[model samples]
Target: MLLKEIKDIFYKELGDIYPKEEVNSFFYACIEHYLKLERFILAIQPGLTLTKEEEQPLFEALSQLKLEKPLQYILGTAHFMDLELSVNENVLIPRPETEELVQWILADCQEKKQFKLDAERSRSVISTPLNDRSLQILDIGTGSGCIAIALAKHLPNAKVFALDVSEKALKVAQKNAESNKVDVTLLKHDILDPELDPGLDFDIIVSNPPYVRELEKEEIKKNVKDFEPSTALFVSDEDPLLFYKAIMDFSKRHLKENGRLYFEINQYLGKETEALFKAHNFSEIELRKDIFGNDRMLKAIKK
Candidate 1:
């Protein structure tokens, strides 16, 4: 089967599952992965044909696609900040919105340096070396380790730690750290629990913990509810904000004074998250939008 022929058959089987545009996009991605061809090359060489050897794997991969498995899981890697991360059912896939949280943190750092006018003056004011030196970050529920691994790669001087309750998740995180060739500490710990690792402090604490309400399950896509880890996606209806409360309380003891807290929040609970953080005396709490302009990220500073 030629590459063009594969595209025709692929859409015939699954085009109704996706829109015309999405089907096209998936066709390009599947061909790119199978052929290992650059997008520009693929474009320039439109007449290029696939040998039967290449077509065999293409059909196999496309079969998975027809099943509606996530493309990241199909590709065996996801691009986060240009770094490829291995993703599987054992870990939650990294979302683009969480990438925004990382950019927001970097922007805040740059803004602070400009506001102080003397980076040295800003450096002199803090007790910990994190303020004077580089940030040390801790990510609770690191999932696929995208947050910690991206930070470790992007922030040259900072040390990043990825923590998760599931040993299976940590194993994925550690593998991502290794594959990225970035040094990130992968630890097995439940952030919701009070007695975790004796209060070692961090300059920045971030998480995308479970915030989905049980009632909202009907609205979520079946792939999400059926495939993603339920423990990493859900909270009790009795306490929809349980993870937020626990994470914030944990941050109070684990974050250095003035250190920041970031969360990828459930949109419906934005106001509730804001009030919860405020009651905990967290300063400068602000809700920011996801790519879709939905309330998604919350930032706070420890007093």
Candidate 2:
């Protein structure tokens, strides 16, 4: 069948759940990836055809999309910063909001030079830097290793490490590091435990942890609650800030003096998160909104 003919059926299949315009956009984007053709070129060359084998995969992906599987998972790869990462059911799909978090951290690093070392608390807040060798960073609850790999790729001088409690998530993270051709130390670690390795000290620490409450699960869209890893998506209703509090405790012991910490937080808990940090004596706390004007990222300096 011709490309135009296929797209007509595509909209018909996905239009009920997705907007007509969005389905068309996804259709063109998928075709462009598979055929290596631009939208205009694909439009001009209607005669270009897929072989039977290729056609099978295309339709298979289309069918999956109709079922609401994310396109990034269907494609098995996603673009983040300057790197392309392999993605699958084993990990949480990278979202644009997380991409914004990455950008904010990068920009924040640029804004600060040296970090003060807090030996008493074993944490450091980012400040002006003296040299490249001193740069250190850690990513907590790294699902697909997106944040760690991206940081390693972008900041070549920084020593990067990623920690996740789930072994399955760590596997995906390891694969992402390999796929991106960057080295990251992936640790199987639960931040709440007191036995955390004591030697690690980071100038900058970032996390996108499970903050969605169990009570809120009913509110999430069907596609997400059904397919993504649940352990990476949920927190108990009684303790929705569990991860944030635990992470702060972990940072108290593991972070370098004057270390700057960043978190991709639950929008509903922005005020609570800032208060928790302040209660821990963290100063210079700042909350920033994403493009949607929702409180999404928080940063603080250890005092």
Candidate 3:
């Protein structure tokens, strides 16, 4: 079958449901994944054709797109930072905002390493080199191990641990960790459980926890609201900061002195979320805007 025909079929089927540009993106992504063809294949070879086997998956993907399934889920993969991760209904697709959160942590790590190196060079006695000292980092509610694995991959000296309440989600995270070639200790423990212990203090504790209030469900698109796991995306409207509160308590018990805490937060509740840090023993509270100019990431240091 002609590849262009399939692209036209995708537009005919999904044009109403998604924007024309988005439909084009979906079509191109499907072709790239299923056929290993570049997006410009049509421009270069306008008469390119697909075998029956190649046509099947594209049509199947189109059928799923018509139902508004997320392209990442349909493809069973998502890209976070430099890692391509396995994803499904068991895990929330890693978002660009989350990538920004990871990049923030990485930038801080790099800056600290550089500062330490400079300080050691000026000192007569150097006790320990920053490269030799391993940073202990933990990711709470690690849906697909995206944050934890990315940190471990970048900071090879750091020992990274990931915790998730759902066993299925942990499985996905473990798979992602192994496939990404990063060693992340996966713990299946609910952060909300007050008695549960992760058993290690961390230099950094991070979570992109469920901060979406139940009241905001209406604002979410159908693909997210209907297909993504609700448990991974929502909190009670009455207590929208439930996970943050629990993570704060957990950090108190498990964070090293001056350890940092980071979170990818709900844009609508930036101040409220930052207040959780202020009321506690945290300092240097900073709320950051994502590319969309919405307050979506927060960082604080444990005092």
lDDT of every model, 2 decimals: 0.81, 0.84, 0.91
Q: How many pairs of residues in model 3 come into backbone collision?
A: 0
lDDT of 1 at 47: 72
Residues 66-160, model 1: lDDT tens digits: 77777777777778877888888887778898899888877776677566556456565643323324677899889999888888777766778
lDDT of 3 by residue, 1-303 (tens): 899898889889998999999999999998899888998999999998889998999999989998999999999999998999999999999999999999999999888878878888898575465551478999999998999999999998788899998999999998998898878898988889999876689899999999888889899999999999999999998999999999999889999889999999999999999998999869999999999999999999989
Steric clash pairs (candidate 1): none
- Candidate 2 per-residue C-alpha lDDT over 1-303 given as tens digits, one digit per residue, 9 for 90 to 100: 677777788988888999888898888878877776678865578787667765676788899998898888888887777778887887898888999999988776655433333322455555444433577889999989989998888777788999988898888889889877888988888887877884778888999999898888889987788888898899998999988888898888878888889999999989999999999999899999998999999999987
- Scored against the true structure, residue 69 in model 2 reaches a CA lDDT of 88
Error of 1 at 251 (Å): 1.6
Question: Which is the leading candidate under lDDT?
Answer: 3
For residue 49, model 2's alpha carbon misses the true position, in angstroms, by: 3.4
Error of 3 at 23 (Å): 1.1
Query: Over all chains combined, what TM-score does candidate 1 have?
Result: 0.90
Superposition TM-score, candidate 2 onto the true structure: 0.90
